[model samples]
Target chain A: MRLLSFILGRAAVALLTILVIVTAAFFLTRLAPGGPFDAEVDLDPLVRANLERTYGLDQPIGIQYRRYLGALAAGDLGPSTTYPDRGVSELIADGLPVSLRIGLAALAIATAAGMAAGIFAARNRNRPVDALVMGVASLGVALPAFVVAPFLTLLFGIYLSWLPVAGWGDGSLRHWVLPVVSLALPQVAAIARLTRGAMLETLSADFVRTARAKGLPERRVISAHVLPAAVLPVVSYLGPAIAGVLTGSVIVEQIFALPGLGRFFVQGAINRDYGLVLGIVILYASALILLNLLVDLAYGWLDPRTRTGR
Target chain B: MLLEVSGLRVAYPARGGEVAVVRGVDLAVAPGECLGIVGESGSGKSQTMLAILGLAGPGARVSGSAIFAGEELVGMPQSRLQGLRGDRIGLVFQDSITGLTPHMRIGDQLAEVLVVHRGASPGAARAEALQMLEVLQIPEPAYRLGQYPHELSGGMRQRVMIAMALLCRPALLIADEPTTALDTTVQAAILRSFAKLKAHAGTALVLISHDLGVVAGLADRVAVMYAGRIVESAPAEQLFATPRHPYTKGLLASMPRLDGPPGGPLPAIEGQPPDPAAVADTGCAFAPRCGIARPACMADLPQPAAVGPAHRVACHAVEPA
Candidate 1:
């Protein structure tokens, strides 16, 4: 019963958080010192009233909220007022694939790099190897994405001439390399530190000593006993790490010219496209909620101790 | 001879110079004979055994001779130690359940020692592993093969550990506090398995433990160490009956007895042994801890004086017992 209550509480928190963000996003975009439809020129008075009536913007705030909430209840996101003949739902559908592809590719890169570095650092302990890896990780974390994005674009995209500097190609595997690497750098460093710290603690545990005395090979002991146990903390941190990546990707998107949701959102902000801005904010928050849920599920699978104890 | 060490010295890096933990200790064991090394923590019993197998961690300073079946153990490379471990030199660790692999299937885990050292095929390893389980008398060996380490009881895991060790017919077996984690009944059974392993394979045994009762049951000869130096050596019965060294006498007296003395609890050893930093001097290491410490005892290191034909004690105060 307690476990059920705990899970329900988490779900309720997520729901309430999403509701508040969505509501605030709806009103804040309107109040952002600009108008959404100020694209070409000033509208005539009669035409502006017709536009207001068409989109139901002429209604009072409370009535408008009730109408929007009713549509939201039916899982309907209305047409984007900033873009003609484009539904908010359609805009989300179009952008989600790009965001997810980038997120997943970056997540994979981070996991591999972080786990390897962690295991290596742990195996080496306080040796020069550990010192070198941690030093590099520190540099990675300290450098902001704004600096890293430009640096990557200049180095790999210009001097090295390995990847395209400013464009994403035909949704192929190759196009993902630069964007994924840029987005994953800080997460990789963070995870490496997490893995190393957790593994160092586990390696000194009584169980590890017993395993060594049982005469397991150095490789097998590290992989089977230490690695699985160590990776758990990294799993728990996936939520915030992915959020950091998603938020970081927006800046990378601006630099790299990836036609992802981040690029769309940036353009919306510049043009004051209220509908587009609100839609993107909702998408971002929902993605965060979904990613965190997956991470929580993974924790239960990784360690049965938590599940049973709960 | 199955296992032998002559004047073995194991050192660790210290300030300016290396600190020798086991300084020139000599031991030899024949087939089917059990030898025990008794000492407090950090007395170098574990280190001495690790040095013999080349299992000491990095930067460890080791010297002297370790000859096992005419093969030199001292200065042996890491690759040689990898091959010898779980194969030529079987190890049964204390804390039985923890000693076994937690993530692995019990049978597959047992077979890993064979596969790693002997290059046994999976099927062959499994068969031999089950046979070993039978040897250790684990119940339902067939079904238990599919179960993991946590699935089994503590006694069963210890049995599996023994089975893994004995599978290769190792010439020498080392049990570092093998039964310390088990209950009284389980401990007896584990000790019985030790005898069976020794008998079946003609394997020599080196039991490193603090438990005198366990030592008395398992060891043919006992070497008593205090402050990283062996202070006395004797047959098990002789050591128990006539413990000549002052430290050895205190250790025996400290053991809880079924027959009690009225008016007071058992006497305690007054103080811990002296610091290891102060140990490698020209005098006895146990002299400060020895109740019968004389001026001569503190002035010069006492050589091993023969008490019985096979027994020796390193103290000037001790006469033939």
Candidate 2:
């Protein structure tokens, strides 16, 4: 009964949050300086009436919101304004994989690099080694990816002439290097700082002293006791990070000219593609919810103290 | 002798300069002998115990020698110290709840010490852990091993700590302030269990605490430290019945008595210990705190004076520098 209540509670909140975000997104776009067809050429006078009736774009804002919510309930995301024949679901389905793929890859790399760097910094506290790694973390935090992207491109793409500079390639290892590096730097900084802070605190805990007294090897002491204890606070740090990488992959997709969803979302926004815009908004919300779920799961995994609701 | 600590001095850089916390303290423990080192906080009783286990923190400049079964431990590295701690010299910490890992099951944690020291197979480690818990007088040892630290009461947790320390049948057991934080009833049970375990293993025990009452019933011999130095050492009854040093007399008087009249002033020592800077100097640190201080007490540090068989004191005024 308790677990059932927990799941129900989470699902209810997620449903409410999704409704608020989708509805707010729909109306906020309408509040923008122009209508969905503002940038397009003037429609044929006779067929314009037919277009309005078919897509329900002719209705007032409230009615349109109501219609949108109704269709959403029925699993009907209306056809894209730019491509009237292509359903909204198809557009979303096509674009989502690219963003989710990069998000997951970046998550894995960031977790590994950050955890190692953090452990190193903690093990070598108040030393030259910690100074070097923290210096890199500061650089990662200070410089934006726009600056990092071009520099990385110049070094790997132009100077060494090793990887593709402006575009993602087809079916090859050559394609993944540029965008992956661009996406990884921000996460590395974030995770390393979080892990370092948490690990430092954990190493000072009384259990750590007790572990030493138990005669366990230093590696086992840090790995089993300190790392697991340290990872607890990093879960909260992951919340915003999940939002950043998964939702903010748009810039990277544009820089590398990847055929990912971020590029499609940007183009849709620029072209004022109404159905595609809603599709992207919904996709962003979904990513936020799922990543948060993963974070919550990780919380239960890392700390049994948290699991018992203490 | 199972454990012999001769001329052991635990020094480190104090804020001003180098200072010794446990200064030139010597002690020996035989099989099944319990030696209680009694003193107030910052008296270096705890530091002396840690010095024996080699658990003092970094840059803690130590010298002289700690020989357990004739193996020297003055400048031994941490790896060897780790090996010796559980397998040869089991260390029982003060705080039970904080000592046990909050997240780990009691059984798993118990099994861990045996596995690390004895390399017992998992099943054997688990079985031994359960048996040892039973030995500690923990009710339903097998069932309780699956429980987390918070699930058990304070006495139960301390018992678990004792069980972990005794699992390998170590030659020397160093327990620092074991019952200091516990209530009176729980304290009795923990002490009873310690006595039982000490007998079962024939382990030489070093019990370090500020509480004289806690050590009085357990100790065969008691060493009383004052301001980073052992000011007095004697057999338990001799120390209690006729405390030679004024500081030891003050400590015994300070304990809440069973025989004294009800609701009276507890005898407290007159002053706190010396400054950490002043403590490390080669002068008598406890002279300021000593009630019977003579002019000669502050000029120079006192050497150990032989009072009786196996009794020693470092006091210029009392022991004659």
Candidate 3:
């Protein structure tokens, strides 16, 4: 029963958050100076006015907001201004799955590699091995995806011909490799540093000392007692970490010429396709809220003190 | 003897040189005996026990020998040391609140010792865990099996920690200030449970604390530590009746007596215990703080002199009486 209420409360908050995001995106996009039809040609002023009227842009801001909310209530994301025949929801449906697949894959690679590096550094702390891990992680963090992406392409795609330089792969493992690596490298570095610090702190906790006192092997003591506490901070960080990965995929998809949400979001904002932009914002906000909720529930499960609110 | 430790020294590397925290201390615990090590904070009492079990933290360098059940433990490989841990040597720590993993359920934590050390099956381990809780006099042992450490009160959590340590029926148990974090009444109750468990299992116990009253109640013999060395040792009653070392005398004198002045201020030992790094190898470390420090005490380190059949004192002013 308590779990039920907790989840219901989170769901309610998630809905409210999505609503606020949608409202803000709607107003901001509309307030931008030029309409989607402006850059196409210097058409007659009367023709442009008629086009505005046809798209409901000539109506009062409040009236347009009400109509948009009504459409949203009926599960309609409305039609795109640039691609007049394509609905906003239709565009999203086409792009979302592809974006999600790549995002999930990158997140998996980041978490696995990051945790391994962190644990290795912590186990061999203050040694040459620890210094080596931190030094590499620092370099990874300093190089942004744009710089790393092209460098990787040049090295593997052009120099050695090891992996494909550009374009998303078609249902093959080789296709996703470069994009995923470029997207995941920075996250992996950040997470590794976070885990290393947390692991060191957890190692010094009294419970860890108690475990060692039991004469348990160092391996068991670290894996069973120390890791659980250390992993908690990483779990909390995963919420924002995941959000960064999703947003980062936009740039990655554009650079690689992929047909994911990243490409659509950029095109929508440039073309001033307000409905499409708002639709993507709503989706991203919802994903963030849900991911954070899941993290909170998992955190409570791992540390019982959080469950009781003590 | 269940355990014998001789010439045990634990040092940690610092900026200039390594400082020995436990300096060549010798101790012995007979089977089924409760030996209490009494000292102020930083006196190296706890480090001595940790070094014996190889639980000292990083940078700690331990030397000399620790013999348990006829096996040398001082330089034993960690793998071999693990085999004796939980199965033959149990340890309970000072703070019950942080002594247990907050994430694990009480039953699983207790059962893990048996499963990991004795290779007991899950079903059998659970049964033994429940039984151990009952032996510790915890109410509703079955219900508690599902609860986490945070769900229990301070005293209950301590009892659970003790139960976890005793699950494999270890031959020797080391409890370091086990009741220090509890209230006076809870401390007494926990001590009572310790006494009962000791009688029931006949486990040799090494109880380390700064509380004279706690040692007087449960220990068969007492070893008084001062600045990384044992200054005096005797049967508990004998040490209290006639303390030889001036430091030991000061310790006993500071304990509030029930039959003494009702409204007077309690006596306190002046000055803090010496830092492990500042202790010199050539002279008595306690001489600067000792009330009866003589010219000889300042120049040379005193060696242990037998005062009675079993009583020993390490002080320049103390002569065999």
- Best TM-score goes to which candidate? 3
lDDT of each: 0.81, 0.80, 0.88
lDDT, residue B213, candidate 2: 87
Query: For candidate 1, lDDT tens digit of each residue in B59-128?
Result: 8888899988888989887667667777778887776445654555777777777777778898999999
Residue pairs clashing, model 1: none
Q: Write the per-residue lDDT of candidate 1 for residues A1-310, one digit (tens) a residue.
A: 8667767888899889989998998887777876655657888879888887888878997788788878877888776776769887888788778878888888888989987898788779889999999999988889878888889888987899888877777877667778888899988998899889999987765556645555567787687777777788999988889899889888888878888888878888877766677778877898899789878878876654455541
Chain B TM (all candidates)? 0.94, 0.94, 0.98
Pairs in clash, predicted candidate 3: none
**Model 1 misses residue A126 by how many Å?**
4.3
Instruction: List runs of model 1 lying over 4 Å from the truth.
Output: A1-49, A60-63, A123-129, A156-163, A169-177, A198-217, A269-275, A293-310, B96-98, B139-144
Q: Per-residue lDDT of A60-105 in model 2, one digit per residue for the tens?
A: 8789888888999898887788777788888778767666677678
Query: Is candidate 2 or 3 superior in lDDT?
Result: 3
Model 2 chain A is weakest, by summed lDDT over 10 consecutive residues, at: A301-310
Residue A10 accuracy (lDDT) in model 1? 83
Model 1's CAPRI class is acceptable
> Model 3 misses residue A111 by how many Å?
1.0
Screening candidate 2 with a backbone cut-off below 3 angstroms (N, C-alpha, C), the clashing residue pairs are none
> Against the true structure, whose DockQ is highest?
3
